[model samples]
Target chain A: MVVSLKDIAARAGVSLSTVSNVVNGYRPVGEETRVRVQSAIDELGYAPNLSARHLRLGRTGIIALAIPELDNPYFAELAGAAIREATSQGYTLVMEDTAGSYEHELSMIDNSRRQIVDGLIFSPVAVSREDVLARPPATPMVLIGEGVYDVPHDHIAIDNIAASHVAVQHLVSLDRYRIAFIGAQAGDHRQSAHLRLRGYREALAGAGLPWDPALAAPTTAFGRADGLMAMRDLLARTQPPDAVFAYNDLVAIGAMRAVAEAGLRIPEDVAVIGIDDIEEGRFSNPTLTTISPDKEHIGRLAVQSLVARIEGKPVEPPYDVQPPFRLVTRESTLGGQRPVRT
Target chain B: MVVSLKDIAARAGVSLSTVSNVVNGYRPVGEETRVRVQSAIDELGYAPNLSARHLRLGRTGIIALAIPELDNPYFAELAGAAIREATSQGYTLVMEDTAGSYEHELSMIDNSRRQIVDGLIFSPVAVSREDVLARPPATPMVLIGEGVYDVPHDHIAIDNIAASHVAVQHLVSLDRYRIAFIGAQAGDHRQSAHLRLRGYREALAGAGLPWDPALAAPTTAFGRADGLMAMRDLLARTQPPDAVFAYNDLVAIGAMRAVAEAGLRIPEDVAVIGIDDIEEGRFSNPTLTTISPDKEHIGRLAVQSLVARIEGKPVEPPYDVQPPFRLVTRESTLGGQRPVRT
Candidate 1:
């Protein structure tokens, strides 16, 4: 049978109130009495019920982070950062993966609102602008990435559009005129892909380059096969592009393979760039030239925002976290090339 | 103002007990009365407090999973599978990332014992056998890969040593000598890596191939860069090996890049193999030859083991779930040249 404070008190020849005070370190007691009470507590092997304590305080000291997929390194790193950030602030983080499924995302949101956690940090997948904007959760919530639907909640993210534009602009600056865009899915209303595509077009227009539909091929999925297929289709064209912009690091790695298979040397023949700057990108053949978003900062900011809101403090505008991005030059684009101008 | 149950009873024109019975569906109420009570509940925006209900029952329908790093695709996929498996069993999975820290692992175990969760699925990192076995938690716990000590709990893991042996044996059967083992770590007692290394040696001995000390090189980390560095160091030798076995898929990917950079053809110039068979392996150049573990099965088994134990059932003894490993032949290993000797 499990022992309680009352049992400890009875065993120690003390009142229940005194035993409670000793356990909580509330009221001062004589040194001898404290030791006796501690000995009794240890002998009984009592375990405090954190859940009951949480219920009494109306605070669970737990937070939930809902991500699309942990298999994706981007989300994985994000989760690690968030966990570290949350733990440092005295909150335990529980990660939930939805695998980018719409129904799963909705169910996770509903579950989070059920108070399993005091607040939620969600990177939703397949949530429409209408659904998110119209039905923001009635609990403390923070939105991560491009699914911001004008909801009045903290939104933490990097500049996908600017990052894309800068990446493409770096390629242009290298005088790679025939640039191809690969690994995008058409009709993806996700703010991330949509904004990045918009930035790609903007970069093209600013450089006085014609937006060639043939150069902007979309892929069915975001895996390496899609990247390879997209690159293969581009290379099969009569006038192959000198450079390719991939959706992410994995896509870029696959496209690089396709380029090598076509007997093309990186930079010397076809330049490539990607986003997310995954660890593998640093060791990819020719390494990868890409835009590196501050993923750690994004995670830290998301946790800070959620924790602050959960504590009932008036947080600065919730959508205030906008992490910076950097363009990492590597062998794919060659070093020290003046950026191409219109 | 929050509406209470008393208000709901008054609005429904019924006794509080009748309203409670109708709300909880305890006793059969008249259809008219049920509808009236339901309407009153909706009007009051009443949502039952599951936490309070759980406290009354002294049971929380939650399980916790503690893993090292989600940044590793294998672990991420494992977490996803575990979540799916637990949800199917009518329990919620709470994920915690320990970042492979021993202190964090201990904390998770302590919390689990403190009733933070009904049961735990823990994949501990940086923990010694004595640390866990010496003081096993009283709660139902399933130890995952990297088993510390014999904690008298269910363990779900693939035979890493045998899996690695199978991978090398496949290479040996191909008559590919001059083999190099990449990504070995010094003084690391992680059962997976150490056992896999042991299997590698056993396979070489069985093949009558002398173990070459120069061929076993340890890397600082298990990332792509570490793989690339190890591969490059091996290739720079006066006589490069004809084949290489990597610790995992990420390391293999790096080795592939290095081999390609050296203008070597896969399978023909240098055969490459790895474990895990990550999804990225399918799209890699020359694809990958790997030992595939049943990640989904391991995940499901972990959940079933914990849930069954929680219900006080005598789980199968040894609970040592050693699943089989399949050697998937890809372009990385010459399909036509695999020589079988008695």
Candidate 2:
């Protein structure tokens, strides 16, 4: 006879959700409760029939992963990591490459005529207050990368502001004035980018350096091309800054390319740094010195968080998981060490 | 007044499968039959109710994408492309990161008891024939990348042998003999890697050069670290090879690093090339000279084929998609030029 979650719950003397939570390992059950559930499961030889459960729940066991695009390796890596985590947890992920579009993102959530998934792990290109509040999914949802400030759901993200500040501070500590900012966004509310930019400003202010608007160039997108464009624009300026902090590695790579095109050497003539510490960053012409997000950890955490929420567990206040970002000072930012902060 | 596949099928006087085939745009119906289907769909305003149809068919509207690892950009890009295409066809994708284990791949399929979605797009790292046929999924399956041969599923992959042949031929054309083959897998049926290796040998055979086993260093895994180790091993041999052909871009990057560590210059000292012209390949130290699979096209086609199979259409036999791979020779193989191939 096929043992069921119901039978397990009955034997364990717990709520059905509790049985589900135990089976899913989404939430931490009390030791005694867990032992009872395990004993009941072992006694009944109960197997979680996903197909049957899927039928009753009307769940497709599919989740939508709305990422920006594949052109950038960061999104590619994030998507890959998420897929790995999701599959392990018994969820299938379908991808929506919006190329960072508000309309496409909104359409993805709004146009329900075509989707059959139970939840969404949306990483929007940019977040709007209206967009965040307007359409929260009726199904289980999780937010990654971008934060939906007012909207509450399971969110997994890196502290963009803190990450940027860390990056800028690293550069400043190296005593490299004439620091430039690349890859700023106009009216950006994704918070990460704006916050990172803000961190750059704060670091400069803390260092008593004048905030130079000419030094900050906002690109149209977050990628190699955008980085190159921003760097090229910076290079063409009357006074190109010495050390440049790019939005991410792709932008940093682009800036390096533009720097090469301009016949200036990296770190020597113009020290360059970036974020997202993509694998390529380590092998670029002048290996990039940048801030890196722990992609593997993030992926694992996102899945664990979603699974928890699915089981109705109380998680940490929906704050970003500031997985320690590392500054690998490579050829691009090789300089004499600066004094440390107390 | 929701439009359904049945409404169109009834109006067209065709089987529901035929109607589904038409809607998914997989099989080619006769001109007269096409017209009838179109007219029926138009008259009924039969917009596919992606959700309810998914419910009735028990389609989670999710497809599982199993790849080795996203740590490598090639798989990451492939996942992104697959997800994007799947999204366009109104399907969400569930990703499974196998990390290159046949057991893991098999377990994912076996445990697919969830009936989450209608199909799977699997890029198996290591699945034996017996194992594959032993517990095949009731749902349609499409194989991508690794372990294509003998798998009873619709397989989508680049012509690895031909692509490798092209890489070697390009190296030969440059008259760089004493070529070292880096990142050759020891024992594997991943036709792409094996074929590419064969192609390298074939090019040598075609050019009347000896296939030097000493120069062929096989690596345990296809990654940067492995590539470096393989290259280092090759460099330590009796006589260093003049040029190197890596299994993939990550391998190439690793080999490039090893060459640099050994104080050799790219192309000038030891020309290096790779396959899967990953994004980083273009921006690497010497800019990798490699073969580029139309990954975007591959991803789109995989989804299209899987969707067709799930919708019960007669898909073409599982054959290698020898989509035109280009020889993108950059700074690594300095003198080589890119042949304009799609």
Candidate 3:
């Protein structure tokens, strides 16, 4: 009869988990318990399959996924997707919150000294491309999200430029002119805001609409509070735009609130649109019109690519993979007779 | 001069992380690299303070926080809070999604045989109290959320019964007599649903309003989709209640959507209230009116409790904590007049 881990645990007078640990080497085992487990294993003649795999791969069988912050529904949702994908690929995804700090991101890279994680999938909101490239992480990593670094790494993100262009064109299709672009981080190359802003300008130019610099409102942060503040500033102007295209859903939701607070109607006085189809958008007042970049797919691709690189598979340079996006038309941008409660 | 890890890395001609691995004894180093690192350490007259700390405390300096899923905004926001609290305490918070499976939770406990994580903070959604207690994790653990496992370990959660009572009382004070309870898991004693349902009955009894079992709608899950379905089920009743008290914000938001889809005016037709003031609920159309249980405080307390237990501190038995809750009145449950465009 085959000696199972359970049989060894029983013989060693320890838990099944203890026997598994002694074989896996993922965690440090106590000296006395470890010896007892080894003795039981020797007598039982049992060898764990995972132990051989870990030894051959020089791995902890753990993958680290670093995101800026989980407070944002976008990142939180992305993390959930990443976890599912990682689990399916036979690795544990350990989430790390970089807290949107460049220094913190650098420190995480420094953690390679301990060699605890086998691979990394990072989505940085704070670290600059220059800073990231200056001191690269030693482990095989796949970059995901807003900005791409100037390093030979597998990158996964939705084409923010094309997606933004589609979102703006959708607003234009609704006969909305004098459109305002909220959330402009003009000087930041690492911010997706820059690419989205470019897309917005291109869409306006293509439609033969005159660019109004005054209509381009800038927000300090890509969050609801900042979006609200930016919308208020736009409204305070003598000639506010007839439409508002926010950078992301959080900004759009904030702008929606500002319009409601100002006693203005959505899609009538000012149409609203955004990117990133976060789940919150589904329940938002009037709902949100957005460009849906499949986050679950992005999560799956990130893990697959990182695992591929770790297994010494041939991955070519400029390993950027931009997933396709689709326009999601919802009530906010669709102007019609508002549904009234009977 | 005191030697640093950097010096050892330079002496060994290996990466800083590689030197760290050999010194920490947490990971397996290549035989050649291990030999080089040891030689470098002896020559450099180095004594790692971190190494001594790790050995003396039997700590990984990393804490594993296992939650059911981050797709739910409550857990997502709680994760953000926990990360911040863990950072302040000089511990790295490693997030693990238990996939809401009892087997997954047990497997994680089994991982403790390796003794990698110093401690654990678990919020189990699927595991029953008996199962969790019968096969306790080898590591020091603190349980948070939903059900409390009857073990010697610490537990942290909101007083769901009291919180639910207050939420129902608030609806009653609004002169809403036919109040329906959304999200009841009738037979599951391990679920907080039982306690919340009890609270709903007591509140109805105190107000001299008769309790109707038909009004206590059951949900398969504690998320948005289930809430939507449960609300639809309630609406199908011959004489549906005029108000709903949801199990949590996700369910409440889902219920709110069903109400709107049925073309019913909130507060006027069906005022809705829920527990857990998730961030997404703040932006939900008609903004959710709910109980704001301090999730951030709960996250902080769980880490603090686990760390205290790990440090061999004088932590008493039945170390359960229930932080206070506050009511947040919002647009969804206070419908009166429509804000018209100027």
Give candidates' CA RMSD values in order. 7.6, 9.2, 4.9
After superposition, which runs of candidate 1 have C-alpha atoms over 4 Å from their true positions?
A1-58, A111-115, A129-139, A183-188, A238-240, A262-265, A335-342, B1-60, B111-116, B134-137, B235-240, B258-269, B311-315, B335-342
Q: What is the per-residue lDDT of model 1 for residues B1-342, given as tens digits with 9 covering 90 to 100?
A: 777769999998999988766554334467688778778877777754333233223345678888886666777777778889887776767788887877777766654333346788999868777777765446778899865646677887788878878888889888888888887767775556677778888889988998998998788667676777888889999989999999898889888888877878888889999998787676565678898988888888899999888776775764677866798888788633221110
| Worst 10-residue lDDT window, candidate 3 chain B | B333-342
Residues A202-236 of candidate 2 have per-residue lDDT tens digits of 88888889999888888777777777777777888
Clash pairs of candidate 1?
A154-A318, A173-A339, A173-A340, B129-B148
**Best candidate (score: DockQ):** 3
Model 1 chain A: lowest-lDDT 10 consecutive positions: A333-342
In the order shown, the candidates' DockQ scores are: 0.31, 0.23, 0.40
Indicate the docking level reached by candidate 2.
incorrect
Candidate number with the higher DockQ (1 or 2): 1
Clash counts for the predictions, in order: 4, 9, 3
Q: Tell me which of candidates 2 and 3 scores higher on lDDT.
A: 3
Cα lDDT of model 1 by residue, A1-342, tens digit: 889778999989998988766654333466678678777877777655333334334466788898875767888778878889987887778887777878767665553234346788999867776666655345588999876556778787787778888988998898888888886557765557777778888998888889998998787656666787788889999999999988888778778878877878788889999998877666555677889998899899888888888887876765646799899888778833221110
TM-score of each: 0.80, 0.79, 0.88
Identify the runs in model 2 with alpha carbons over 4 angstroms from their true place: A1-66, A75-98, A107-120, A135-137, A294-297, A314-322, A335-342, B1-60, B111-114, B135-137, B314-320, B335-342
Candidate 3 Cα misplacement greater than 4 A, ranges: A1-21, A24-52, A336-342, B1-6, B9-21, B24-58, B186-190, B336-342
